[model samples]
Target chain A: MTVQLQRSATVAGPVRRVRRSKHRPIWEEQPTIAGYVGKTVALTLIVLAVLYPLYTIVLTSISTQATINAAGGLVTVPGEITFAAYRQILSGGIVTRATLVSIGITAVGTLLSTTVSVLCAYGLSRPNSFAHRPILFLLLATMFFGAGMIPTYLLVSHLGLIDSYWALILPTAVSAFNVLIVRNFFMGIDQAITDAARIDGAGEWRVLGQIVLPMSKAVTAVVALFYGVGYWNAFFNAMLYINDNSKWPLQLVLRSYVLQGVTLPGSGVGQVDVASGAVTGLPVKMAVVVMAIVPVLIVYPFVQRHFTKGVIFGAIKG
Target chain B: MSKQVADAAPARPAGTAQRGTADGGPGGRRRRPVTGTAHRRTSASVPVRKVSMWAQIKRDRSLLLMTVPVIVLLAVFAYVPMAGNIIAWQDYSPYVGIVDSPFVAWDNFERVFTNPLFLNAVKNTLLITAFQLVFFFPIPIALALLLNSVITPAIRTTIQSIVYLPHFFSWVIVVTVFQQIFGGASQLHRILAGHGVHFDLMTDPDTFLILITSQAVWKDAGWGIIIFLAALSTVDPALYEAAVVDGASRRRRTWHVTLPALRPVIILLLILRLGDALTVGFEQLILQRGAVGPGAAEVIDTYVYYQGVIAGDWSFAAAAGLVKGVVSMLLVLGANKLAHVFGEAGVYQRA
Candidate 1:
């Protein structure tokens, strides 16, 4: 890798140009040292801005009660660490229950959302399939116009879905934007292939299952990730629809404990850890935040590359 | 994305779906021979037939059937809720239901327009939107340009992975993360207070705009860059080569080549941003409203939720939300029309 280039930067523009050509093309000019330093510093700051908060959260969550107290709020430089917070929270407390609830919601919601979107997308994807234009319009219309918050809540309630998981899943499961993304991906597939399949006596179902979906796995994965993340991260809908604390997703739990400073209930962290003053609710709160985030972290890496394919639908991004 | 397309394109039409094809039933016999011409001619231009409506429905029944579930879900949820906006004019009582609720005509609207709380919400909503549009919107554009200049793919990808992580986190988590960093007893607060600079960022009303806008940027700005990067990817390298060969400097090349290529996408996004100007992070604002107080934090969404869902003043809240929705729609249309006037495609082109 190092064999291809010169490293003399102090020389004139021609010599500097030779060194830069390994990284940049010959047509591009050498970046000034000022620009180089500025870019490096800016990139470092941007990366740190994201990384530092995360590091502190992880550190603070794992730090011992003694360590947390010693280091004070948000332990940047780590000391003694413990899993007591993770154990206590994940050990059949309200946090554990909320985690389970979030898992269930994310799993079922992602599946349902992906299926409906894919089916509807493929259905409307055929270039001149009967009534496809009208159907596409029907789905697309939802993107630009909508009933606001109150009416949607009223509708869900009217459906008797209040405090139900269906309130979380069903109302938002098949968003039109998701449908459009999938549809756009489907449209990008060569029509010749689908047409050839049709001539080979394959039904639309077979074409979708056998041919189209397998080809468009990138968009499918991306759309699924979108819905899964949406479901996982959603708290507003739960707040509106669910009054029962038991139905609260990890987000609402995080909101109450971390954001609102509501002491955890059903083995409240504040209640048990009082005498020591070491295990104040900060670790518990941060642990819940971590739990809420971990799924997205786990799944995101796998789906990371598919997003460009997903948002290739300029309709959604723009 | 290029890698995926390359892999997927080569793998397609390989007779891989043996089970799927074997399981299919009665496709060749029942449907028209409209597709019969497809295999003979390598081209996709199939001859057309004038089929009756019934024939078309019968032919496409399975495709139509596939769309039914989505249609049902949208109808029951989206369209039904939209229809339920009637309650804005009605004195909607949950006990009475929409069927029995007394239609109060312009009563709710009249009250909503006059109510100081609603006005405060509207003002807050507009301020947040304007602030975000000015401050938050250009961040992704600039970042995309910077990241695109980053010649090393590994470095660029690593940065992207780190930044996009928070976009997947809930607003609750985003708020909590910010709290851990900037809360009353946060590291920054503690550090600052030790220097005799005591201030609580969470509760302060004055810097709430900056605080929330920064939050929005942190949450979304990374993910927002993806689309711009995609747009930038489509810009031909030859254009840059030509610009450089013609003695265009870096700044001039960017101005002439990069900015022009991004202009359509930027305009389209601007139109969309204006369309969604009123929706300035409902969940974000709602989570912080108690801390910052509603005076600074309450926007149309939170106001609607508070007055309707929280306070049980459904009609008044519905009226407020209805006005916001209508205004949002008008903004999208107006902005789209403006884009068309300037010879740019907005969300969609004119029919």
Candidate 2:
């Protein structure tokens, strides 16, 4: 009877395999020609919706002044491409300064935010740890409620964080949602390994540093990406706190120059004097726009694979 | 609202390792996840001991210390700010401060509710959110279904990477991209002008609703699809096989077996969206509010900013913000209740 059951299980596996079409199950009907064409068209439009504007803007940024004028607006096709916009902006100006500022914030904020959140998550991971439930409540409560903008601004002001770079980082640093997700992951870890380490004379700190974290690299990386992206793309915080123009991050720079009708930095000349992030040329403005997009384009791919990995998806299951 | 975008990674090594151990271990009621070191496997082998809370605290001092920074941050930045909401009742003054500011009770609330500008802002915020709810919400679900049909893993992943790329983009970039393409002197405009036709899009208040909604779809709809796709991938194929064996057609199986699998995720997203009803693109609106004029663009967020931060009407702005926060909280709570009635988990669970 055991032999017969084992033989049937082996047969069932192959039978299931026989019905698949590479990525799809054979049970689903084959898509119609019309449906396939419709799908392709729809997908192409969606891809183009994101890519085309970006393509044109990036193209315009690099295109020579003559090419820009010939195109009469944003350049779709490249002509005598030059890195003049890049050269002018990156040389030494508010644009350059803002770029440095943003990089610093993204780097520092990601480190601080990731470390704090990971520590918090690990601290709460142990089932029945001291005050774990109440601590978890204290963190999760912030997710449901926020101090309105007025109060938050006032707090920042009173703390003398207004116009300070720390204001952007500190006020919104601890993402409670992140804490919850990481905590869930930590709790999901087997307790036996930690207990073994504990018996072998490893303390909680040593065990976390040596064992739990090495196993948690995936979630930690993903959490860091979230904070890094948050800091890099942060505009509203800068808008609210930093009235000092010199301390402006890239998003605010992009906003004031590009979107709000291009008052411009130091407008004119083939070699534009880009003081305080002003620019008359569309290429320079588009260059700044490219600056805002490049980091996300670079970093998101590495983090992208983790979406299917399920450490994060498990938290969503909650 | 928060950048809690689709974070669906599979289990880490520790989790799978734990699951392996669970499968090999004893099968009994003790297998359940009861808290405390008391019932843990290692403790079982070592002989469990009943420990006091103070002893537990002393033993777990390092772990507790690790959580202090976050707890302190929440207290100072989050909880303290909520406490500061009281200034809404007072005629708040920078010179006098909160302690000395004269209290006026509902007068600030009355002024904010009565102001036509604030009313217009509320009207515009609701109108935009409702329009996007109808038009923009389903695009991601459709996209997920569409992407799911591709019989190639490489192609599906590539499409996903390209599509969700826009979620990371700042509002500045999103608006700039739209403006360069659809603005009055834009690519579309240039093409139309060559035919001697005139139509304005970006800066036009008349078409502002369509413009911003398109931006919303472009920027967020792709990111929003992540949760749905994750849900789709989790649907058991056995259910479909059973449906097929029951004489259900492909269409019926998709409608019955596949779509229902997505019901919880859809309901959760809907609850979250409803909770954010008062907050329709604060950064996006503020960036473009000047172009379309406040008549068509102001939201409660910008109203609060303009009133409190810009105009120095701290009391009035604080009241407006308080009203928005209260209403948003109620909306989330109410929607979660509604979700519970439908047998969905909604966003969070009481249990």
TM-score per candidate: 0.90, 0.87
* Model 2 alpha-carbon drift over 4 Å, by segment: A1-21, A267-280, A310-315, B1-50, B194-196
Question: Candidate 1: lDDT of A187?
Answer: 84
**CAPRI band of model 2?**
acceptable
How well does candidate 2 match the true structure in TM-score terms?
Answer: 0.87
What interface RMSD, in Å and to 1 decimal, does model 1 have? 3.0
lDDT of 2 by residue, A176-286 (tens): 988877887777889998889876767677788998989887888788888898899989899999999899999998888777654655632123335522223778888
Chain B TM-score, candidates in order: 0.86, 0.84
CA RMSD (A), model 2? 9.6
TM-score of chain A of 2: 0.87
Which one is best on DockQ?
Answer: 1
Report the C-alpha lDDT of model 1 over B6-76, residue by residue, as the tens digit.
12221122233222333324333233334342234333453444443433454566677789899989888
Indicate which candidate wins on lDDT.
Answer: 1
Model 1: share of true interface contacts reproduced: 0.77
Model 2 chain B: lowest-lDDT 10 consecutive positions: B1-10
DockQ of 2: 0.40
Each candidate's DockQ:
0.54, 0.40
